[model samples]
Target: MTRRARGLSLLLLLALIGGLTALLWPAPPPIFQTRTMPLPGVLAARCDEFTPRVEEPAEGVFVAIGYDLANTIVLRTSAGNVVVDPGMDLARAALARDALLARSPGPVLAIIYTHSHIDHVGGARAWISDGPPPQIWATDAFTGHFIKQYEALRAAESRRGEHQFGRSVGPELLPCTALGPTPDLDHAGSTGARMPTHTFSGLQTLRFGDTEIELHEAHGETHDQLFVWIPARSVLLPGDNYYAAFPNLYTIRGTSPRPVRAWIDSLDRMRRLAPEHLIPSHTLPLRGRDTIAAALTDYRDAIAWVLAEVLRGANAGRDVDSLAASIGLPPQLADKPALTELYGQIDWSVRAIYGAELGWFDERPEQLYPQQDAAAREVAMMGGPPALLREVEAALARDEPRWALHLLAKLRAAGSPDPSPELNIRALQTLGEQTHNSNGRAYLLEAAIRLRRPVAPFAVAVDDELRAGLPIDLFFAAMGARLMPERAGAAHESISVHFRDTDDHYVVTVRRGVAEVVRGEPLPGTPTPLASITTDTDTWKRLALEQDSAAWALLGDHLDVDGSLLDLRRFLAYFRRGA
Candidate 1:
């Protein structure tokens, strides 16, 4: 072949290769970087220094005034004012209210909840004192979502939540970040949460005076999440959808499986909007269409990439632990300010995706029906409790707190009598101080505190207004979860509760330390209840939830008892009343 012809062909091939590489390469990082804000501290010492400051991200949007963790967005529309995700509790709500009142004395016309989380909706009642009770709006599934969490997993969630938020640990011992203001753990549930007056399914567009607002239901952080978009201003209010740090696909505190794919799709939907100003619930807002687009695109790609890697490993027969260790964000994506592991770790995302796709079983026969106390038994065989304690102490002395914690846990589970509670407390304290993850630090410190003293039982305290509105069945289900099997003493007792107000009948049967609630009239063949109690719904709630003395209700004419009073007292004794 001629030299000239061959050179021309080689140039074309080189050009084609360069074009493919450009197309396949990860998008170049955005020219403008998103600003990084200091993490907030919930403890009193650092609370003042780390308290979140309120700022107007856009022309009319104010954020971070109510609480440090959750953002309260106050937008002044043509008609009046719109408040989004009020605050964590009454105090935080008051802070938000004062901040809003200072800027604009106008009344609030509407309150919009991004989701049903307590931090988002707990302060609803605080906003109602002014104005003609602003109309509250939320996703249609919000109420059902709240009920499911409260009824099915309240006990477990409450315990984990206390740890995740560092409620029990002092700031001097364990300094946590991004946890907003410290919440009043005891009075949290007592705070009012106004029910949504208006609910929509998917997309709802409304004209509040001259401004047109669009609400789109997007499932990401929560199943009932909704993002607000104002096309005229090009402002996007994504509640917990696009935060500063990495998205929390799986919270260590334990939560229902979040739909990772749906979460990615939600980000994609926001990216398509090309919002000029993006104000999220947890962090400072971002302005400029190009910047917002790039950030959202990157966020979506990060989540999708992690999920893809996890699925890839799963499909290749890799276990969850292996996937967690192997999968991570590529350098280009990981180094982004918005995608840092401040809140969520990539390892957690891998395990979450793997669990969501393939479920609990890792296709291993040994794990299918493994012995319940396998770890404890194995630890026992390895040298009994004393030996395990000695090893744990040695690990702690060597400055390997994580390893020490693991060994300590196994020692305790193996019924170890050595190392005492004091030693365990010291180890946990060291672990808590050394850990970087806020949730991990909180968990370890809280464990140390529990070892030092008896922790109080978690109380489910619903506001009076909310409690009155809830279905009777929900109340009974919550009560069933609080039953203490040990206190029941193997007695099989059945009690029929007749709610005169609602005309609902429920038979609660306790057998072998398990409590089961059967709705409707008693079965014909079932054993007759030992005691029958007739009460109003309010009285039932007081007895079941508020832990009010049963004698007071009977004397107050709130409850009427038939059959054995002693049997009724015995039945009630099974429940552990919180202080």
Candidate 2:
């Protein structure tokens, strides 16, 4: 070989070795180490509200505080003991139960769920006794509201909740989850939602033992929410309606439009009750008729003012972003202890209210068809990737991490390979440290870690105990939501499913790009399904949730497939779960 050719080959070999070493080498640690920062004075002071204890708001009324994200209230009466809001999970409920039982050993005559929230009702089974089950009571809309959460929005909400509750971040980052104690991420709890046996609409009164209970439908955070009023005791248990923090007119975790107008109305109703003792499902209890009345009045006015401001701004043709920036409580309301922005902030509530009132259209044609990609390219070309990186660095130095994040996004979208994960991490950490809102703080810090490494989609496994309470229809409905339309391209097939345990039958049809689910048998003119399967509800949940494999279930006789197993596997592949 010629000497020149030999030298070219040697250079190529060196390049190949360098490439392999680069690929194999471990990445260096992040430039900035994330540490838990000290909480601001206001947030630090709020932590005291969540200290675990049991307090009596009135005679014979006991509230187990800080047991979970919610409180458990036990009302002792001559007839028996009444339990209000069992809390988030089995262990916490059991702990609260044991503590309450130690104080009042009377049999629990009734269990009242203020609303259908998991934190309020999941621990109902833990309150069960061998003697007889306590009658569960809730508003008539409870079941429908409960099903809506578990079915359509399940996966998305779970992901958002991880941030909202600071589940993905370290405990030190969140000393208190605003309404409750720092989320116990180390211990997974069992959900025990016992469906309410009795339901009411509008208004209903019940006499349990010697205690007279009035259930009034008060839509606020949830459509099915209700506040419990005991006439004799002059005590009111105002569920999630009146917590110490500003009412979550909009939760960052996401929800259907909360009834802000109705929320204000509900607060008005509480003020009218004139209860000497006011115990909430979250935070500490309030006593004294005058004090409780004043708190309720201020809370109501705060919500009403926010709603009015959003409606006023929206009607005046102002954009949503501008509306959010401009609206906040007046000093009289902002200074009130009951109207703090710990849990929910005014800006988020402003946007939510605006959207709910006027819809997503902002009257701008350019916004109608967002030219984000075109804009990103234009931004990238303005100064190129190097210039953008310098801007990000400068933004970080100026303590403007949010601006740094915006620049980083443009860099990433431009497809630039600027090794700036360290820059991104520092920006996110700075933002998390500076944020006063617990939800935003957690999300920013968690995003920093996720930028450095792959973060798994948060999921809660379907256990046998929890599965029994779930409606079989939810699993099938969720299957449609989990469908991967692209993967199901050009595929049109139907599978008939029968659950022996619940005696429920469903027809799941994957047509082109959508999964359509129909309950019971098919209509007379319906086309014949491609396959049929028989399984118990529990086994189906396990299979659908990917906790158990279809192949294993078929082989173990846990599932009976009438058609080819290969075909069944292909059908299942059309859907995906998690984030």
In the predicted model 2, the residue pairs found to clash are none
Per-model C-alpha lDDT, please? Answer: 0.70, 0.75
Best model per TM-score: 2
Compared with the true structure, model 2 gives a TM-score of: 0.87
* Model 1 lDDT per residue over 189-292, tens place: 45667778899989998777777888999999999999998898888999988887788888877788898889999999999898899988875678898989
lDDT of 2 at 551: 57
lDDT of 2 at 150: 58
**How close is every model to the real structure, measured as TM-score?**
0.82, 0.87
Off by over 4 Å in 1: 1-51, 173-176, 182-190, 369-394, 420-423, 458-463, 479-495, 509-514, 521-532, 547-557, 562-579
lDDT of 2 at 550: 51
